[model samples]
Structure formats: C-alpha cells, structure tokens
Target chain A: MTTDLKAATTMNLTIDVAKCCGSGQCVMAAPDVFDQDDDGVAFLLDQTPPDTERANVDEAIASCPTGAITVVDG
Target chain B: MDAVPVDTDADTRTDTSSGGQATTADDGAAACPHLRKYSLTPPESRPLDEPDYFGELRQECPASTVTLGESGSSWLFTAFEDVKTILADTRFSSSPLTPGFPLEGAPGSDAPVAVTTMIRSDPPVHTRLRRMVAKDFMPKAVEGYRDFVCATIDARIDSLATLPQPIDLIESFALAVPSDVISKILGVPVEDEAMFQELTERMTTLSLTREEQYQVIGEFAAFCDRLISLKESEPADDLLTRLTHEQLLTGELTREQLAGFVIMLVSAGHDTTAGMFGLSVLTLLQHPDQLELLRSGARSWDSAVEELVRIHTVVRMGPRRAATEDIEVGGTLVRKGEGVIASILAANHDESQFGPSRFADFSIPEEKPKHLGFGFGPHQCVGQNLARLELGYGLPRLFERYPDLRLVDDDITRLRFREGRAFFGIRELRVHL
Candidate 1:
C-alpha cells in the first residue's frame, strides 16, 4: 500500500512563516521539499524530506495558498 | 457590470436544503431576511458559458446573506469549502477601505484618494506591500522568465502570420502576448508600447466614465511617473529598474508607492492574461476533443492551463471582504461589519467542489481540485508565477502555431464578451487561419 505508507511515515516538515502567502505554492509544489526566500518567504529545503520526498511533500501540502505548509506524521 | 448580480430565480422562498445552512441574523443587525438578492445584472452568458447563475448559487445557500445595495448586506461565499474559508480567513478584511467593504462600484466617503493595490491591502500593509514584489513573482522568479516568455509567445505567433485572413484573436494573439510579456517585465518603453497598450486599454475598459475613468487614471499615473523617471536615469535590468534601485531608493517605496506599483503591474499584468488569452482561446475552440488532448501529446499544458483556470472563473465576483471579526463561514454567521463575497465564480463552479458532473466539464481529469483560480489567502496571485508562465507558453503555443485555427464564428453569440470588466474575457476573437 504505497510502500506501506512510505515505511510507516516520517515526513516531518513545517513552515508558517507568519502564514506565508508569497504564493510560491511551496516552490511550485515541492522544489526539493520547498524553497523560496528573497522575501518570497517559504523555506525548509528539506525539513525532513526523503521517503522519496513523499510525493513532493504531499504536493507541497496540497498547493499551499496559505494553509502555510504543514506535515507532521513523525 | 457584474460584481454579483445573480438572481437566476430559484429560491421559491429560501428552504435552501436545510443542511446547506445560512439564515442567521437574530438581530445580528438587520438584512438576512432569508437571503438571495445580489442585484446589478448584465453578464448574461456566452464568454465560454458559465452564468447558470453560479450553478444556482452553488446549489443554493452555500453561505447565503445577499442584498448588496442601499449600502448593506453581503456574506455570499458559494461553497468550495466556503470559498476556501473566505479566502484563507484573516478574519476577512482585504480593505476596500474597510468599514463594511463590499465594493461593487465602491467609492463613497467623499471618494478621492485611491491607489491602494497589494490587492487592496490587509496584513501588515499586505505584508509590507507583498514583500516588495515577492521575489519578482516567484516560481523561481517565473522560471527565469521562460526564455522571455517563449520569446513573447513566438512574437505573438509571428504576428499571426501577417494578419490578413479573418484574424482578431483579441487583436492578433490574445492581446499581443500579455501586452508583450507585461511590457518586458515592467521596464516598459519599447518606445512605450503604443502608449502602454493605450493606457492599459483605458484602464480595463468597463465602458469608461467616472469622468473617463479619472482621465484614464490621470494618464496612468502620469505614465507611472514617466516610467519612474526613466528608471532613475537609465538603470534597466527591469521590474522598474529593480524597484527603482531597490524599493525606490530605500525609502522602502513611495513615489506614490512606485506609481501604485506601475499602475498595479500594468493593469494586473495585461488585463488578467488578456482575459485568460481570450478565454483560453474560446476554450480551445470549444473543446475539439479537448483540443485533441493538447494536440496529441495527450494532455498537459500544465493540466490544460489548470483546466482553463477552472472553467473561466475569471475573477467573476469573488475577492471582497470585511468581517474583521464574527466569522462562521459556510454555516453562515458572518456579522461584525458584514460584507464578505469570496465567490470566485461560485468557488470555481462548486457542484460541491467539482463533482455533479464536474462544473462545466472541460475534461482534463487526472484528478482536479486545487483551484480558486489564482485566488485564496494572503492575497493569492502576485502575477501567479507570471500567470503560469503566460498560460504555460500561451496555450500550447497558440495551438502549435495554428493547426488550422478556426473560429471565425462558430457562432457563440458572435463573440465580443468583456462587458464592464471584472475579468471574464473575449472581446474580439474572430480567428480562421
């Protein structure tokens, strides 16, 4: 089942930069688990990424229009 | 003239599916007397069909409270998770100078001073004027201007093969490739692109008047103060010479907010992708098997430009807010200084969010959802990554440089749409290759 939910989950990630709305949509859906800074906000170039970057960190937490990227499943 | 007109008859007196909620106002201060009002009509269909009265107010009462006049009622919302919780809820306030901002022709309180931009400010000044042009429209700074937006969509498809045969397509190639890729990313002057596309087409022509739209918004703020004093004495590597040498020489911007960010980025970068490239080229010439599945490469001009920006939501009466407190959303409530809206053409056609036969189905389904069509929170859409790199290379390079184009009247009410603009487009398509 999708490699048993990526070997029983780990993912991690978190963002919030005051609910970042620089609308990079998490660097256009997970450019290596999100990047954007020169004031476009969003950061974490891999807060915990790999499990083959969990389907682009869950499509950058489902295309973030300010639900400001999250993903716990630790 | 439609920034909420919707009546399309159906209320038969507001029962609104009982479960769909909204009937609040036990003196939550007047005006919800069983909702459904919305006045000021006009968009009576055919710019790539949608007006089935917002799919009958998104199956009635998606978050009700209507009225919108004698300066009163507002709420609206229309499903898709209550228009994504009134556009990612910052307790709703995108200021049309707040104090009950509904903004359908808004201008009172002895109206005068205007240039608000940062899409009518909210967060700490719309988060310091959208973090000074948010890393120049980010998706890796618009994928480093995709080869100057594919050489301005191949020089507007090689000036539509030297014009002649029934050509219009919004004056040769969907308004000349976003007015030559937003006048070369706001450096402007290619000998002032014919007076910046005639003052951004009389500032988005809704039949100008309000004294000729304030004398073409004072000649487009004196042509963005003469292109910010010729980019402060010749500097150029554009985006107004890096915001005229970084935020207008460190006063962190203000030459009337860099001429209201070059008249709000050349009238929202060439009239919303020149009305989404004339309504995504009249929806790929009314879906020729979805333009032969993006001409046989079997789908993906980035999911057919995000399903033609979710069936031409075209800013159809959405983004307006006020609440500032007393929220509630889909189950209604609303209150504290009221006026809400959100709609985005009824939450990108919410048949409970893209089901009930996928809201005006244009078929590109490999799973869809995720469309408020360039709108949602902290003012979503800072040139939506240069409008998806100009509709991902201007709709498959204008159907791969005219595969026998066609459309010189397949009679969709003889084309011309765009009336009193709040972005829904096609005011001249014609075509014929």
Candidate 2:
C-alpha cells in the first residue's frame, strides 16, 4: 500500500488580477501549466503534474514574462 | 534600468543635432581601470561567424559614446549613472513599432516608414496594438505547449549532441525554436518558415540600396498579400487569421495594413529572440563561471532572464520620434520630422550604476535586476512574454544538458555582427558540445 507522504499542495500559479494586462506571458512561458480564459487571463491547471513537468514549470516562472506572473502556495 | 542622461554640452561634448541633448565620452585614466575590462562586444566587427562586437566596445570604449556613420544615432552615455537618469526621464520615448529610428535614413510622419508588430509604435497606437496582440502572447496561450517547445528544443539538442559536425546554435536551436513557435502562432506550416527567413532577410536589411530596399519591400508585401488571401478563405487560430477576420471585424485596422502588421510580428517576433537565444548562450559560455552559478544557484530564473536581457540587449537600438513639437535628447536642436535612437547595448553595459561584478556575475545581488530589454513606457515590446519563454526555459535546460558546453575558439577577433537594420545578432555560432 502507498502512503500519502506530502502535505497536499495548495500551491499553484496565481494570476494577479490587477496586474493581468492580458499579455499571456504565463501561458507562453509555461503552456503546460497555464491557460487563457475567454478574456485571456492566466489560470493554472492541475498544479501538481508529474515531476517530469518540473522543467517546464520552472520555465514558466522564469519566463512569467510580464515579469508580472508568479507562482504561489495557497 | 534608468536611461543615460542627455549630456552633450560638457567639455568632451560635441554638438551635432537633436533638441539639444548629446552624449560625451570620458576615459577615466587615473581612476578605475577595470571598469573597461570585460565588455560584451567581440574584439573586431567581422563577418557572420561572431556577434559580440559590443564586448570589445565595452572594454575599449567603456566611457566613449559613439555616433557611427552618417545616420547620426546618439550612442550616448558611458557612465551608468547617466543612463539611469535618461531611462527615468519621460523625454527619451520609444517609437517601438517602426523602422524610423532617428538614424533611419527614410521618411515617415509621426508614424513610421513601415508598419510593424506592436513593438514599433508610440502609445495610443502602441497601446491599442499591444492590447490586441497581448491575447496571443499571454502566458496562458503557451500553456499545454510547454512540451511542444521542450520537444522541439530537445530534438534539436539531441541531434547536436550526437552529430560529429560542429553545430551552429543559431540554425539548430536558435532559429528552430522561434521558427517552430511562430509557425504555431501564425498557424503557418513549420516547413514554410524558409519563406519567413528569406523575406525577413530581404525586408530588414539595413545597408540595402534604396532601390533594392524597395524591391525587397515590394516582394515582402506581395508575399503577405497571398498569405492573407489564402488565410481569408480558410481561417485558423493563428494571429494572421484573428487580425484579418476577427480583429478587423471591429474596424480597427485594414487588411492591407494588417498584412504589414503580420510581417512585423513574423520578422520582429522570430528574429530578435532567435538571435538572442544564440547570443545568451554564447555570452554565458564566455563566462563559464556564470553558467555554473546559474546551474547551481537557487536564484530565480527571472533574475537570470532579466540579466540575460540586460546584458545582451536583444534589440540593441530602438527608433523614436520628435512628436508634433520638437523634443530634446542627447543635445543639439532640430525642427519637427526628426528621429532618434536609444542604444540598449550601451546603456545596459554602463559601469556606473551596476557594480562591475553585480551585472555580469550571477552570484551577486539577488534582488531587482534592472534591465530595459522589454523597454520602457508605452512602446515596450509586446512579444516580450514569448521572447522570455525561449530564454528563461531554454537556457536552464541547455545548461543542465550540456553542462560543459562552450565556444570552440576563444578569439574575439573572429566574431561578426549579423547584417540587418532590425536586430543585432550573430549570423552563425559554432560550438563544441
């Protein structure tokens, strides 16, 4: 039997509503982790992907592009 | 980062023209000698093989502001202090959407000689154009495509790692990455990117004869004409389709003009970032210690990204305007209908603001890394988000994979700047993987 070792990650990429200028830096930076709404604001999907996706998630943070978007743990 | 102040009236100053602001060169002989030690420019400006001429300038002419050729662009500040001031001043505005640099030998109005993607316009126009394109460049748009970018980069890196022939990063990773991304964004087939390279070369060549420039312009226009028409019948999720059918639905811009805009995106979007990719790798490799620090340090990738942009300054100089009334800049006054250019390369390297070690050395201050690679004010680059996508993601993976990667020959004499009016980048970069 497997044990749930981790404290469930409430961590995800957050979009700052006031700073959301609709320039999809987050999506462009990490498409795997972020997506645009109808109005083109960024939202996170499945924050905890497999560890293999870490490289991309790191890229998203690096390229948050607007120098605007950021990652957070709720 | 703040811009260098307009100081032309000093003793070392020479009055050329502007609304009366000019730059001066000061070689501090008695003071700090190392300030000019490690410039980013390669030693001599050669052919396409090398692209780091600015490093040599950084070392040799660290305090000298150069105004090369008859075009008369103000290479401006050498001291870091002045640059910060200029960047802060609202006077040094950007005409980010055009080819009408103060040094641009062509003619246009408050508008530019040519239509471009969002980066070339001054605001209100810059504001609108950027907002329209922002939907496509947002980080959200790139979601789910990380693997696509990763796969593309990995495949190329894989081939390079295995192949015996020396690999040129510009072609394999640099050009390929952006070409792949743009093709996806434009909904154009990846194989068709050859046409883009050809058209980009022809349209953006700076030294072309006026007649040749016109011919290239005509050809570019003709090519876009057909592409827009074809996309008109069969629409896609690409930028061209949105601009043609959807964005135009609002009557904001015309199809003919929109075609020009597409050219700007393809040309500006791909070329600057692609060249920058190669340049970033080259610069980092030049300082292997920095690469190692980047690999091991827990410092943020955004810091590295900002530093990369600040150091390399992908688009070295951007165009600007006189606006309706005459404006002042690095000294000397002129009437209306004049132009100016801001040297990003010079400003980024200025030694006054950043401690000599703080900028190039990755192990320094982990706080706010000042950089203008995204530019300032109304006309900051609209595609900055996408450009960072390549750098921020691609660099770390590159380091992780080819930890020992470096330039084969360490001679500054051999490097040459790419030939074009648009962006300063290498034509080719051969490396030992």
Candidate 3:
C-alpha cells in the first residue's frame, strides 16, 4: 500500500531564492526536504520526496512567509 | 450575521495625508456603534489579558470598522483566516508613506522623510532592507547563538542568587537577558545598561505625550547614529559592522537607513523578548501543573513557548496596512485607500482555527496550530528565531534553576500591565526565589 502510494506520487519542488525571506518557516516545517545554506537562503534537500512527505511539503509551502516555495504534482 | 444598519449621515472623511479619497462601499460602516469607535487600546489598568470585546467581536463581526489613530476609521479583521488573508495579500501596503496607513507613531507621506525600514515598507524596498539583515537572523544563524543565549541566561540567573528575595524580575533578570543578548548581537556596548533601560521604559510608555515620545525617539535615534559612526570607523565582527562594511560601503544602504535599521533591531529585539520573559514566567507560575509538565520534560519547551506566544501575543495593536487596492475580507468590501488592522491576539484565540476552549486551554495540542504571535507574511518578525532561542533556552532553565520560584503578589488585579505601551507586558513581576 505504501509502495503504491509512493509510486502514484510524482511531485516536483522548486524555490524562488529571490523571494525567499529567510524566515526559515520552510526549514521548520519540513527539515528533511528543506535545508538552509550558511547565508540562510533555503535550498531543497529533496527536490521531490515520496508522497509520504506531501503533507510536510504542503505545510512548508503554506508557512513560507514570502510564498517562495512551490510544488507541482505530476 | 445580521446586516449592520448603515447610518444615513455618514462621516465620509478619508486619510488627509495622501490623495484624500473616500471609501467606496458601505461608507457608514463605522457608523454602527459597536463597530464604530472600537477602542484598539487595552484597558488602562488590568491583568495581562485580552479584552473580552475581542472574543465578542470575533464571534459577532469578524470584519468590522474601527476608529484608529486621529479619528481614522480602519477595517479591523478579527477572524483567524481573515487576518492571515490580510497579512498574505501584497496589495496591502505596509508603508506608512502609503496613504491611509493606520498607525500613529511613524510619519506619513506628508511628514518629513524618514528612511523606511523593513517592517514599514512593502516588496522591493522591504525585500532589499530585509535581505541585508535576514542572513544574520535565520534559524541556522540563530542556532550558533544558542550557547551565548544560555550563558547569558545563566549569568542573569546567577546574579539573581545574590539579589534580595521578592526582587523585581523585570529589572534583575527579564530585561537584562534580552538587553545583553541584543547588545552582543548588534555589537552595542552595554557600558550604561541602566540608561538604556530608562530610555526603553520611556519609549514603551503609551501614555507619554506626542512631544515626549518624539524627544525619546530623537535621543534613541541619536544613540543609533553614534553606533553607526563607531561601526564605520572601528569595524567589529558583528551585525552592525557587517551592515556598515557591506551594505553601507556598497552604497546599497544610506547612513540614515543604516541608523534606522539598527534602531529598529534594538527596539524589536530588546523589549519584546523582555516582555515575553516576564509574561511567560508569570503564566507558568499561575499554572503549576503545566509548569510541572514543562519541568519534568513531559512537555517540550518549544511547544510550550509556541503555546505561550499564542496565548499572550505581546504586540498589542498592529500589523496594520493601507489597501493599495480594493479587497474583500470576511465578506466585507474594504475599499482602496482605506486602512486595515489585523487583531492578531484575537486571531490567536479564535476558536475556529484553534478548536474548542482555545481561550481557556493552554496545553500543547496533538496538532499544533499555526499562530500569528510573531506575525505572518514577508514582514513577520525577522528576529523571531533569535527570540525563540532566547525563550526556549531561557524559560526551562529559569524553572530548573529556581524550582521554588513564585510570584510575590498572587493577586492578579493588583498586578500592573505595561499600560499604553506598543507591546502588552507585565510591568513588574516581583518574585520570591
């Protein structure tokens, strides 16, 4: 069931680094999928995580103050 | 909701600072008594608590007109979703220079030019000013300061050991921790900490006349100006020096803007954290069972801090904006050129977002609710990670160190709120160690 869920989920994640305010809301929400550089600009640890991380990613997207993070489901 | 009766004789006055344009829809929205003349200021003397009217308004009229500074009526959004919508929408200008920006302190478009800081400006400008200092306040950046925060907190706690029992926590510990921490970060010398505290006290006092407030502001600004010059000449490994070397030297930031930024950082960083410390300690003392949970590690400091922040939102009356264009929020059509104020304290306690007994319950729930304690959107508190670090390390350790600490006066009514202040905080918490 888990494998099927993962197989069905194909998501592409992207961040507008310019729009990133460095509030770290993304890092707080999904540490596994998101990480910050030494300068604190967010860079994706996982550009596309399994469907299991959908909720976390969604939270990150919602929580990003600048709305910098985006995800497209394929 | 019942259709509010619009007055036939409506006051059609608009913000005079900009192109004086009247609101389009429901010109008499502020005519309704409850909606009209809704006082944004808290009760002059009371326990540190949200006004009962906030709950009433949230339940009755989530979006309504309110009389703000200088007879300016603004759309007050009390609902959780509505407040979030207002914050997230870029159409709402954070700049006081923008016509109809509903705040009293800062200059409007007509007033003499003051360099707009990150919190007061929108997009491109806000984006630029924020980015200059954003790297210094990110979670990872703040993480590196955890040891400094802990040591600072430890030193304050140790000092309390020598002071008399039933000492004022606000003076001895609460204010000192953040003051020291912010000083360390900004590279400001703490040679006269007492003088800094006095100035902060005067600045935060809401009852001060406009002239007195401006006098205090000038003095504070002059201090900041001096600090900027010092940073220019004697570069130190600090945030101020970084701004001076990188942004100032590169001509990305003007000297005036640099001074404004430093003043903004100190004002934002110092009192708010100090306020939170005093309030949080008071709250834990009030709830012994919860305090036990926190002390025993049954409840995490992070969650407790989040909950504490939600319950007692220190920022009394703002996250205000002028509508750059007409926008509908919570079924109310707020017209272009009108101002709006999001009641974050009310939104934090809204039962809809936080579930039942949000007002009464102060526990860490299974699914933690997203709160606007540090506010939301691009202009949210940039120093929040640092504030969180201060609270997270400061609170539990405080309890651990002084297990028997209790409030000197348990009477809530007798306690004084920082009346008429920019932020709501306990003025003085006399505690027995």
Candidate 4:
C-alpha cells in the first residue's frame, strides 16, 4: 500500500488526438488535468496536477472513453 | 453554473445543543447535520437500496451531506457542479488522514485507522504514484492492443456461435469478454485463469471487512510477488516484467508499490467491465429500435461506446473530496476534510442537463453524456482506454454476430440494484441470441 514513488515531478500527461477519438473521458475524470480545445481534443490544464486531484485523475484514467490519455513519469 | 444559494442555517453545525438526545429543530425539516440519518428508504428494510439512496439524496440534497458514525466527519457535495469543483480544487485535499475516518462498511471499531493506497495520497506523492501506472495505461499504449482486444472478443463470440440451444448471457458473453481481454493483456497464463478470476473478484469487493479486505489483498499480493519474482528471473516484454526490470529501475516503486499496481489493474479493470457490458445489453434490449439499428450494420459503432457507457454508468458513484477551503457547492457549505460522492447515475439521468430522450437515441448528443461514471477531476480511472477497447469493439461485433439478440425475460426488476451497493449492476441478466 505504501509506494516508494521517486518523485512526482516526472509526471506529464500526454494526449494523442488521433487515438483519443474525443471521448472527453480525461476531461470528465480530471477536469483540471485535461481540458477541451475548440476541436474537442483534450489539452493539459495542468500536466503537473495537484495531489488533491489525483484520485479524480485516477478515476478519470479509469473512466476514459477512448483511452487516449496516458500518464508518463520518469 | 453559480453555486446554489444556502439558507444560512444549512451551514451551522448542529450537535446536541443542551439536550443529549437526537434533536431535529422540527420533524420533516431538511437539516444539514443529520443528512446521513435521512435514509433513502424508510428505515424498515434490512438492506439499503443503492440507486434509491443516490437518486433520493441527489433529489433531496443537491449538495449531499452525511454524518459519519465513528469519524463523525460531515460530508457535503453530491450535486454535479459541486463535485467538479471539489475534485479539481487543491485547497481541500483527499489526504486520507481524516481527523477520525469513518470506516465505510465497517463498524464496532472506534478510531479505526484507514488503509493507505495511491487513492489515499495527496499532491506530490499522488503525482509520483500515478505517474508509473499512467505510462502503461495511456490511450496510446493501450491503443496498440485494440486489434488484439477486438480479436479476443470476436473470437469468443465466434466460438459462442458454435454452441447449441440458449446459454446464459452473463456467463457466456458478458463476463467472458472482459476477463479474456484482461487476462491476455496482463499476460495471464491459460492454466492459471480461474485462479486469477477468483483472486481478482475478492480484490474489488468494498463490502468486505478490513481483515477480509486484507486477506484478498494478501492473496493478490502474494500472486504478484511470485509473478514479479518469476518475471525478474526470466525477463519478458509483458507489463509485469517491464515494470519490475525496466521502468522500476529508477526505484520509483517498491515491491508493495508494484504489487498495488497489479492488484488495481486486475481488480478494477475486470469487474467494472463485466457490469458495464451487462448493463449496456439490458439498456439496448429495453429499446427495440435502437437494438435493431445497432444490429442493422448501417451505422458506425464508434459513436455507440461513449453513448452507451455514459447512460449506463457502470461505476456510478465515486468518493471524492472538496479540495479547496470551505467550497460552497450547489449553495450548501462543505468544509475542508469532508468527503463527497459524485452520484453520476443521477447526473446521467438529469433532464435539465442530458435531454429526456429515452435510452435509444444514436445521434451523439449536442452535449455528450456528462455523467461522471469514471469520475471527474484528477483521479479518474487509468484503465479507461482499455475499457473503451472493450465497449468500442465488443458491442458492435456482438450485434454483428447475433443480429437477433434480445432478452428472453421482461422483468429485469428482480435483478435491480442492490442495497448499499458500491458497484452499479443488476443481479442476473439473460439475453437470447
């Protein structure tokens, strides 16, 4: 349960529009972490998102419609 | 949308003013302090009804409130708008270190210390923890497996065609589809699948006691421990080995951290998909024309995935937090440290937001179903892309294979929502192909 996570600074969420299909799942799951551009593609509201929003992001990651959003950490 | 205007008294904390007994300023009044006691059903039943609890609470208290038994933490924020603000804001944190945490589904223990996981962390720790899993689950990473996922589902459906007479819909198709997909992705060996299924089922049950929770977790933990050891000894390109040898090289995840990731993937990934698949078929069966169109093979299946799952919020309610300091949600006051459950089922059914078109409308809504099935805010489900792979590819292929698929039974009410349920689903759904 206790994770020896190195550092959260390596965190960056990448959204692939081609693969995304504009399901808006990432936008729904973690609104602050993902945003919708006019074209309906998801853009980062905050790639390095806050801790409080992590659970929602996790839920979003769980809820994605297209599976377009992926979290990348070093 | 602006926060709802509160009636001042809604914010005042009430606890035994002078009298030692339960006090309602007046009977039938919607007082904030006693929100949890206001049952969705009259207090005569042995078990609680989940949908009614969510539906009733959403209707009665826009920003739902509850008083915990042990922790005594007052919860507020269920209205769709409030949930959005609360989960995104940083001021109110989901730092699991509640002053006195309510042991959800567990009682008889005072000052019970809550268990910790990535879901329990806040800020930097959460960021670091989620980052590791994020890499594997990203849509791009998951998208590569789409063809494989589609093949898995298609192969099973094809095999089902070879069978005689009527078969159980849930066992034959619904459950088989996702379990097969997850097992393949996790690189689960064919010989160990039933064991995998047994272990994962216990892993996701929220109603179990803390000890039972730990026991199931232990089974899974042990499985992952053995798995990692094997993978470490003999490296492979599978996810488990990749995490153990390659990605984990930087020491980002400890042994427990790695095991937690595996447990989450196995448990959260499979169960919800089974529920979602069953619910979608039920939704379609209720609407004949839509099922006909979906089976018509004229319309593209891409649009149907989001639309179907949005309406059938599989993971209907998710526990969230009011991240900011004293955020006013839907006009009600929720202080820092209070928990919130986003009743996505109500939000999905809201006529004010999602138009009142009964379930069958195939035309993508002018506004997509804003239901928070997966969740809203930072902590959404990581395995969602994989879920999409199942829904997007699986449903259409299903109809294509069985053009005349329909439910044999009319009364699905008996299979209605369970009491105090954490997951959203019906008991037994039978469909005839």
What's each prediction's TM-score?
Answer: 0.33, 0.68, 0.90, 0.72
Give the better candidate number (2 or 3) by TM-score: 3
TM-scores of chain A across the candidates, in order, are 0.32, 0.61, 0.87, 0.72
Quality of candidate 2 docking, DockQ: 0.21
Clashes counted in candidate 3 amount to 1
lDDT tens digits, residue span B1-433, model 4: 1111111112122222110111122334455542563222211231112334555555665664554333243354445655565555545455435432233332211111213345555555655565555656665567678888888888888887676646566667777787887777766666666676677555444445546656767777788778778778887677777778854566877777677667667667777887777777777666676566555654445555666666666654345343334456555555444455445555655545555423434344433455666665456666776887788777777877887887777654444343333445554566667
Off by over 4 Å in 3: A1-7, B1-33, B40-46, B105-115, B355-361
CA lDDT of each prediction against the hidden true structure: 0.70, 0.56, 0.75, 0.57
Candidate that would win on TM-score: 3
Report the lDDT tens digits of candidate 2 across residue range B288-403: 76666666785666676777677656565433433233443333232234334444555566555454432235343475456666754334566776777777788888878887
Q: Tell me the lDDT of model 2 at A6.
A: 45
Candidate 1 lDDT tens digits, B109-210? 112324366777778778888888888888888888899889878887877888788878886777778878888887787778778777766665544434
- Between candidates 1 and 3, which one is better according to DockQ? 3
Q: Among all windows of ten consecutive residues in candidate 4 chain B, which has the lowest summed lDDT?
A: B2-11
Candidate 1 chain A: minimum summed lDDT over ten consecutive residues — where? A1-10
Q: Where does model 4 exceed 4 Å of error?
A: A1-74, B1-30, B37-60, B67-76, B100-102, B106-116, B247-249, B295-300, B322-325, B357-367, B416-421
In terms of lDDT, the best-performing candidate is 3
Interface RMSD (one decimal) of model 2: 4.2
Q: TM-score of the candidate numbered 3?
A: 0.90
Docking class of 3: medium
